[model samples]
Target: MLEGVFMSFGAIAASYFTLAGGGGSSQYANAVLADNPLAFYQFDETSGTTMADSSGNGNDGIYSAGVTVGSYAITTGPGRSAGFSNDIGGTTDYRATVPYGSWMNTNELTVAFTCFLEPMGYFRLLASRYGEPGTDWSWFVYGASGTLRFHWRSSGGTNTNIDTGFTPVRGTKYYVAAYVNASESGIRVYDATGLVGQATGAGGTVNSSSRPLTLMNAATGNYTANGHLDDVVVLGSALSTARLDTLAGIALTPQPKWINRTAGVSARNGTTSHAVSFIPTSAGSLLVAVISTPAASSAVTAGWTKRVAAHGTYTECAVYTRSASAGDATIQLSVSISNVPLHYTVYEFPVGSSWHSSVSVMDDNVYPVLTGLPGSSPVTVFACVSDRRLLADTAGESVAWRYFWRTELSQETLYGGGTDGIFTGIGVIDEVYDTAVDVDAMDSHVETNGSGSPNRVVFAINVA
Candidate 1:
């Protein structure tokens, strides 16, 4: 048994435990979650007419016009999402209205959210403050081409519009943020990879209005959104591009005493390679964990190997690597096995941090366990790759996996599925990443088929 206070995973189905110490908080929680915004709606309630404000502000929202709580993609984590499907000519519409507050009466402001657009034939409003053309502000999709559009009226009765120029595809989730200041305004659109489209303009000052904030539709119930939305945030001041990118789940800026995780998966056959890059703001050691499916017919003799030339001085485990590099590091895995799947994760740790890793072969119940290092704040990341032989026998296998990552100040649990033996399922199945606050120990259980066939499991514990 590990010594220290144990934190529960809570609502996360994954079985994992952490030992607490030093009481250091997370950098991300401090930067993003603790920024003291005017209002923030996680949209995670199971059943409620009122959407609670997570920013500790008293600006609660009321559901209206048939807005329903629904499930979103795993990318938004385990939570309920707001669902909206507007009828072009019919009265069927939905929205959430938050009463007017001081935060809504600022010239310098920012609005951001994660939205899944279905793209109907007519114009659809994703969010707005009022319906008046020359006096209101709104973010919407162009009916003709589905381009993301932002419109805000200035104090002088002049209306400014910004376009992303890139049309949103139906049934895809996008992270969008729009801001307006006295001199300039802009809109940024991001997908899983990174920034996709952006537009900026100068000479526009936002005007204050008496209208309440409306989400997923116009205040007049016109042009309603036809999809899902979550993680709505409203700030009184404009945020930097780096901070916005971090909130959009792209990348986090590395700082002293900070931890960040980056992960991805590939199933290309015949001696292929997959790589991800990260630049540390300061010099430090990094903990890297990788899991790959074994050879199709036999156990993996020589598994994935990290390129020392590309990464740096590294210590390799069965499927994990610990690298000590300065400046920039590129985590590359060269796979020689044919027709197999590969998954890799690279975790960047700031100075004064250390990490340890462990690996296990899968059984009916697989637990990738790592003993905690003294004086290290521990956060655990686990990745499990299903055996290729088990997939060859089953035509359409749906594998369910759950994993959790927590920093001292916050924790996030995500669940996903994949087909066959390929860990290409939703969310973080093939690639797992997470960071935790002052933790002393780490362990987790991953349940798979009872068939004696073995899968590859990798675990890493980072102390800062």
Candidate 2:
């Protein structure tokens, strides 16, 4: 029987569940939540003259002229996107502007979004801040060439122009990111396959002006956008290449349901068990569980299980387990090994919108039964735990692990770092694997440490 179980909880008024130790506040978590953006427009509203800022930054955009919200061109999960068309009668058409603030004064900034452009003869602005002609910052695409561009200039005439050399195809969806730092800036353009073009420019300071940020058109309405725009995000800092790549890879649809949780176990000399319990406020949520075991513990021997209630039967899910050697032993619903710490993760789907019981073991390898709801529906919620024993020779050594879950289509796009016994505690490092996709196909690479030391890692996802 399992013994010495501990439970802790961190509550947020929001509907989504978050991990302990303030996991929701991390930068990586912020990216996943798409929270705290200087300005973020999901364009998910059905009808409204005002474009709500989902970032909670209060920098809302007010629609003007005949700008309308329409169905998203690619993914309907996000519902709708802001539409823009040129009006020859001198009307401004569709555009939005956020009031000016100090947060807009950063020397570094990142502008990212998904867009589908229609063919046109002139330049079209995606987003911009207008100042007197010689002093402006804008991100736009050349309508004829489809080249992504970022132009910034100071009143003194010092300026920079960064552009992607490759042209995007008209009428196709594309992800674009522009990064601007004090003396340099760059642009990354991505399509369905992967990265298309990247270019950087050096020189000139990133000028800050009092102009309000505008979307889909310039302040004067000269360069109007002729396309569909969705999932727009504007950040105060210039993000790294890897983060940009991550933003480009994931599905742009905002997840309707999700949660995250984590647990840690200290090393013990003999067989000991630890478990984390997560009770979803919503019934029938899908659950994705991940467990990381540090090398300090003795090899796990498949002695773990999850139960919906204290005495409920265990449910099945797709389980993938790995061990250091081929000689590891196996147990029912678990794996057994000696002298090698291990990691385990599971993806459990809901049954017709209903949740079931679950159980887990701390072994080197796992072959969990793959049974649950299909991927067509969104996951409602999930819980996870890590249980293990310390090596007799490695008693008192620390053993730690963490896991999290998100709805389908909410998978993480990028992950870095390898399994080399480097165990950074939750939220300490920027690299995190919180998405279900990380476990489904083992999409991210994991490197093993040859030493008998512990190799552990926690994976969590941030939901918006």
Candidate 3:
């Protein structure tokens, strides 16, 4: 029995089982209980709040309407979910007390949930004990996986995995159960099938007698899980194999696929080479296009592929471009169905190189203008000029003479060069405006116009 003395007799007040019609506060009446059982109140991005009564009076306090005999206290935060609660000192602002004072080394605790494969990333389902402000103890950290892996750790911060065993297949449901006990702490993953695999053999803090733990979807500024979570449950005591099976049988709450892709990406192209990259806003196969204004040298299509790698949470990709010459290029990334290889094209110049003078309407439209060079093969450097002009620095007075090619040309090429005082390329009288001139193609080449190398090269690419 709970610890509380009775004062008045039993009286049934108008219980608010159903949420008031029209509208109320953010709190909602999930169930109607004759006596208000102690509940953990949280209001953040993961778990939002709901109103109880229709007057919007249900702010963030412990209120007892049905039973007027004994009273319970609560800890309330102004805006978001505050720390834990002990109910001591009348719910002013105290941390939550750990159950049984502390954890028993022999005892155990486990949490289980269902997730999807939409937002491939990390999540945190913690067994935390709240105390003073900023003083919180977390037991486990786990979530969805793809190109990367997302798992949790104990007090020692050991990596404990929490995957569905089977690969994360979108539109499909999978269950992940993280177990923390005295014998050992491990994870058992399951897809639509029964049991996939068990990754036991990890050490963690044993919060046997911990406070009410919460399911936290935490992201460390990386890929986020885009999946649904349902049927969240906590075993009152250490769960056994039989108990785990029973709990898994129960229905769970459902969450939507998390879209964790960032806003955009930045990349560049190189002389006689093209660069590539893409930003995903959701979980789906995309088609990437690689195009050059005059077409690439080898007419080779770059192959691109993405998969769950790091931490098994986010998607990582790899693309390859064939040997090509100087040209204006762009890569367009698009999505298609699963199992189908990611579509991408390589746009290279047909005969000569092209240089972009100023920021044009196609500035952002061009994909591989400033892309990094590949490490495998050396790219022949070329620059297109309106009048076959020599590259010059911004000052124009500092005439560059010697050229230094890209040194950090591991993944991409970085070239610079030109002559300063006696320049004849820019004023070449009969030269065509769009003439492709092959410069020095080496590991690292510098463009010089004066005593030093050319300042910078201006280039343009077409998306169409």
Model 1 TM-score relative to the real fold: 0.50
lDDT of 1 by residue, 186-213 (tens): 8888765567888886645567777788
Question: lDDT tens digits, residues 213-260, model 2?
Answer: 777667766676555555668887788878787766663322222232
User: Which of candidates 1 and 2 is the stronger one according to TM-score?
Assistant: 1
User: Cα RMSD to native, each candidate?
Assistant: 14.0, 15.7, 23.8
Clashes of 1: 7
- Predicted structure with the largest lDDT when compared to the true one: 1
Between candidates 2 and 3, the one scoring higher on lDDT is 2
Q: Whole-model lDDT for model 2 versus the true structure?
A: 0.42
Q: Candidate order by TM-score, highest to lowest? A: 1, 2, 3
For each candidate, the alpha-carbon lDDT, in order, equals: 0.47, 0.42, 0.27
lDDT (10s digit) by residue, model 3, range 135-254:
133444343444223243455434455444445544334455656665566666554334555566454455332333322221111111232333233332345555444333321111
User: For model 1, where is the 10-residue window of minimal lDDT?
Assistant: 13-22
Winning candidate number (TM-score): 1
Instruction: List the candidate numbers ranked by lDDT, top first.
Output: 1, 2, 3
Candidate 2 stretches with Cα past 4 Å from truth are: 1-36, 73-91, 131-144, 154-156, 252-350, 353-464
